[model samples]
Target: MSIVAIIEFDEAGVATGSRLGDAATPVLRVDDLGPTRGDGVFETASLVHGNVQALEAHLARFVQSAAMLELPRPDVEIWRDAVRAVAASLTSQGVTSGSIKFVLTRGVEGSGVPTGWVLGTASPDFTRERTDGIRVVLLDRGYRHDVPQTAPWLLAGAKTLSYAVNRAAQREAARRGADDVLFVSSDGYLLEGPTSSLLLRLGSRLVTPRVDLGILAGTTQADLFTWAESAGYATGYELLTPDDLESADAAWLVSSVRHVAPVRSVDGRHRAVDGELTGRLNAALDARTS
Candidate 1:
C-alpha cells in the first residue's frame, strides 16, 4: 500500500499483483532538468496474452540505452520482473494488451550516471493512433543509421530518456499541422519519427534503418519483419535517404503502442494513407501472438 514520494515505480508483485509504492520520504531530483535536455535513455515493450511481450529484448535494450548515456545500469532483472508483474496484474483485470515504458535517470547523481529508474503502464488504447492513421511531414533532417559521428555518440542509438530534441522535431512537424513528424538529418537521410522508427515499403521488401546508424532498433519493427519474412515478403535494411522515402511505395512510423501505422503525408506533400499492405502487415503481426 505504501508509495514513494517521488513515484519511483508504479509496479507491483507479479504473482500477487500488489503495488509497491515509492517511499513517502522525499528525494531531491537535481537531474530532472537533464532529461529535459535529452540527457537520459529509455526502452518500452508491450504486454500481451497476460505476459510481457519480448521481455528479454526489452530489458536488453533498456540497459543498452542506459549504456549509451554513460549511465549506471540498474538491477535489470528486478526491473524486468516488475514489468512482467505489472502486466500480469492488468491481465487479471481483463486488460489483454497494453504498453510498458521504462525510463532510467541520472537524477541526483553528481557525475550524470543513472541513480534510479521508473516504469509506467497504459491500457490497450493503441487503436486511436492505428485506426485513424498518422499524419506526417518530412524534415530536411537526416537518418544517421550508418554513421555514429552523425549524432552524439553518447546518446545515439541508445533510446535515451532525454527526448526534448525529438519532441521538438515532432512539434515542428505539428506546427505545419500533422499528427507526427519524421526527422531526417539535414543531409536528407531518414533517421526515424519523433518517437518511433521508420518503416517503409519498397516493392516486396520491408526496409528500415539499420541500428548501427544511430537508429533505435524498434522491437515492434523487428517483429513485423519477422512476420514479413514468414509471409513471403523479403525483409531488408539499408541506409535510406529522404529521396528514397519521398518516392517509396508506402511509408510508416513504427512504434510499440501504435504497432505499424501508415504515414498519410510527408513534408506538406499529400500522399495516400491507404496502403494495400497495411492489412497484410497487421494480419502477419497478429498471427505472431495469436
Candidate 2:
C-alpha cells in the first residue's frame, strides 16, 4: 500500500487540485514540454519527522534551475505553501517520513507558461543498504569535464528533468549487478553518482569532485562539508579519478535523503568501510537535518 499524493498548481503557483489514493492520477496535455521534450526542472527533498530537510536550499536550487532553462522563476512563497499543504495532507494520513518532490515544466507547447506540482509519498526503506553499503560501477558520461563551461546548451550543471541518460546508466549498472553508477567524465575525472554525490576520505581530509566540472552541486555534500569542517576535518574539491576511490580510507555516496551511504565496492574492487567514520558522518548529517 503506497501513501502518495500529487498536488497540482496553477500558472500563478497556487495549489489547484490535490488527489490521493492509488487511482488518482495527474492529467497532462500530450504536448506538455516536460514530457514531450523534457523541458523542465525539479528538486527532491527528504521529509523526515514531518519536516522537509534543506527546504530553503532546495527552493533556491529550484529557482536557479528554472532560470538556467529560461523558464519563468516560480514564486518562492507559493512553493512553500504547496509543500506545506502536501506535508499536512500526508501527515494527516499518518506519514511521518517521506520524499517530497517539486517539479516545474514548460507547459503545453507554445503556451509560454509553466506547470508545477508537489508530490509527497512514503519514503523507501534503504536502512539495509545504508547499513551494509552499496556496490557501484563507473560509467562514462560522454562529455569532457570542461564541457559545461564551454557548452551551455547541454544544461550540464542544471538538475533538469531530462534524465534519460542518467536513468539509462543506472539500468546498465543494474545489468552488471551493481546497485548504482558513478559517472566519470570523458576526461577521466570522477564526477558523481547517478543519484548521489561522490565523497571520499583521504586521511582526515574530505574530498569530492569539483562542481565546476559539470556535476550537479549536492546539497547534502555541502551541509556535510560545513559540519565536518567545524568538527576539525579538512575538505577540498578537485578532479578525482577512480584510483582515488581505490586509495581512499573510505568512500560514500551522500545525498539529502540517503545521508551517508558507504561504498562496499566500486567496479568489483572492495573499498574500506570505516564504520566508525561512517557513524560519525551519519551523526553529523542527522544533527544538521534534525
Candidate 3:
C-alpha cells in the first residue's frame, strides 16, 4: 500500500490490515515524529519465489545499524513476519519477481522505539549490458569512519537509511561524464563504488578491498567471494589504489541491482573486459539462486 494506513498491532503478534488513508507507505503520520525527522535505519533484500535470500545476513546489518543510530530494536521475528505478510499481499496482487526494500524507523516519540516501517517493492529494471561498457571516474571523496578498522560499533557496517550522501556521489560521478564513482580513502586507497562493491580480476585472483577500509560489506560481493574461493579463483581483499584499479586486468561493480556490470573505461581511458571471469561468476550466482 503506497498509503500509510493506521496500523494496529495486537498482543497475539498480529498487525491488522492497515486502515486505508490518504498517505504514502513512506509517509508516517505527519503528526508522528520519526518519519518527519528522518530518524531510523532500514534494509532492502531480494525476495524471489517467496524466499528471502540472505535474510539473516541482511537483518544482522539492519539491527547493527539501527543500534548505532540509537534506534530501538524491534522484535526480529515480528518484523520478519511483517515483511512476509507484505510480500504475500503482493503475491496475491500478482507480482512475481523483483526486490523488496524494508525500512524500520524510530518510533513517533522520537525515542529509540521502532515507530514502525514501510516495506516496498520495485520491478528492479536494468539496461542490458552494453559492449561499450561503463566508464568510471574517481571522485576525491573516500569513506573515513571516525574509528577505522571497520568495527561494528562505528556503524560502518550497518545498512542505514541515510543514502542521500550516496546519491549525491552518483550525481557527482555523472557530472564528470563517468558511469560510476570509486570512493578513494583520504590516504588514496580505493574503497568501493558509491552504490556497488568494487571488484577486480587479475588473471585468476578476484581482489576486493578489505572492509576495514570503511566500505559497506556488500551482500553480492560476499556471495561472489564465496563462489570465487571455492572455485579456486583465489579471492582476496587488500587495499588498492587508483593506479591499481586503472591497471587491473578487468573491473566490475557488484550489487543487488546490477549483479556484475563491467567498467570498460575510466577517466576516458579504455580497458578490456574480463568475459571469462564474468561468465564464471554469473554462472555461479545463477546456480546458487536457481
Candidate 4:
C-alpha cells in the first residue's frame, strides 16, 4: 500500500496546505517540467517504526537543491506536515519500515506555479544486503573532484530528478557482475555511490569523503558520526582514494532506506565484513527518535 499527499502552494509558491490522495491516481499534468525536463528537486527519508529519520537534514538538502535549480523555495512547515501525515498513514496501516519521498517541481510549461507532492510506501527487505554485504566496482564519474567549484551549473551536489546517468552506472555495475558501484572522480578521488554514501572505518576512526567533492551530503553518515563519537569512535571527512577504501578496517554503503550495508568485496576481491559493528550501527540508526 502507498499514500500520497498533494501539496497546495500559494501565489508566491509557498506550500500552503496539502490533501491526501490516491497514489495510483494522476496528480501531475502532461507538460509538467519535472517529467518533461527533469527540472525539480526531491528528498527521500527513511521511516523506522513510525519515526522519520533525519527529516530536518533531508528538508535542508531539499531547499538547497531547489535553490540550485532556481525553483521556488520549499515551505518546510507545510512540507513537514505533508510528510508526517503520509508517514502516519503508512504507520497506521502497520508498515514499520518504509520511505517517504517529497518532490518539488517547476510547474506545467508556461505556469509559474510549482508542483509538489509527498509519497510514502513500505520499503523492501534489505536484511541480506545489510548482513552478508555486497560487491562493488569503481567507475569513473567523468568529473573532477573540484567540479562543484569549477562548474556550479552542473548541479553536482543537488538531488535532482535527472538520474539517468546514475541508473546507467548501476546497469554497468550489473554487467560487471558487481552488486553496486563506488563512483571515483576522474582525478581518482573517491566520491560516493549512486544512491548512497561511503563510510570507512580506519582503525578506531570513522571517515567519509568530503562533501565538497560534488556529492550529496549523507544525512545517515552524519547521524552515524554523532553516534560513533558517543560510542568512542573518532570521525573526520577527507579526500579519500581507492587505496583508503581497500585499506579500511571496514566499509559500508549507507543510505536513508538501506541504513548500513557493509562492502564485502570490490572488483571481486573479497574483503572482511564487520558484522558485529554493522549490527550495532543499524541498531543505532533504527533507534533514532528524530
- TM-score winner among the candidates? 4
Ranking by lDDT: 4, 2, 3, 1
**Higher-lDDT candidate among 1 and 2?**
2
Could you give me the TM-score of model 2 versus the true structure?
0.91
Q: Which stretches of candidate 4 lie over 4 Å from their true place?
A: none
TM-score of each: 0.81, 0.91, 0.81, 0.99
TM-score of 4: 0.99
**Residue-level lDDT tens digits of model 2 in 1-290:** 23434445666545555544342555467889999999999998877777787888889989889998998887787777777777777777888778788888988887665677777888888777677899999999999999877998888889899989889999999999999989988888999987899989999999999999988889889888898899899999988998898899999999877888999998887777878888888777666553
- Write candidate 4's Cα lDDT for 1-290 as tens digits: 89999999877666789999999999899999999999999999999999999999999999999999999888899999999999999999999999999999999877789999999999999999999999999999998999999999999999999998999999999999999999999999999999999999999999999999999999999999999999999999999999999999999999999999999999999999999999999999999998
Error of 3 at 64 (Å): 1.4
- Regions of candidate 2 where Cα sits further than 4 Å from its true position: 1-23
lDDT of each: 0.65, 0.82, 0.67, 0.96
RMSD of 1: 5.1
Q: How many backbone clashes does candidate 1 have?
A: 23
lDDT of 3: 0.67
Model 2, poorest ten-residue lDDT window? 1-10
Task: Please list the Cα RMSD from the true structure of every candidate, rounded to 1 decimal place.
Answer: 5.1, 2.6, 4.0, 0.8
lDDT of 3 by residue, 1-290 (tens): 33122334544424443433343434465654445665667666665555555667667777777677766554666566666666566556566544656666655563323456545464454444423357888775544532355444545655666667778988988898988877777678888876788999877798998886667788878889998888888888887888888788999888764567788888788889877677776656545542
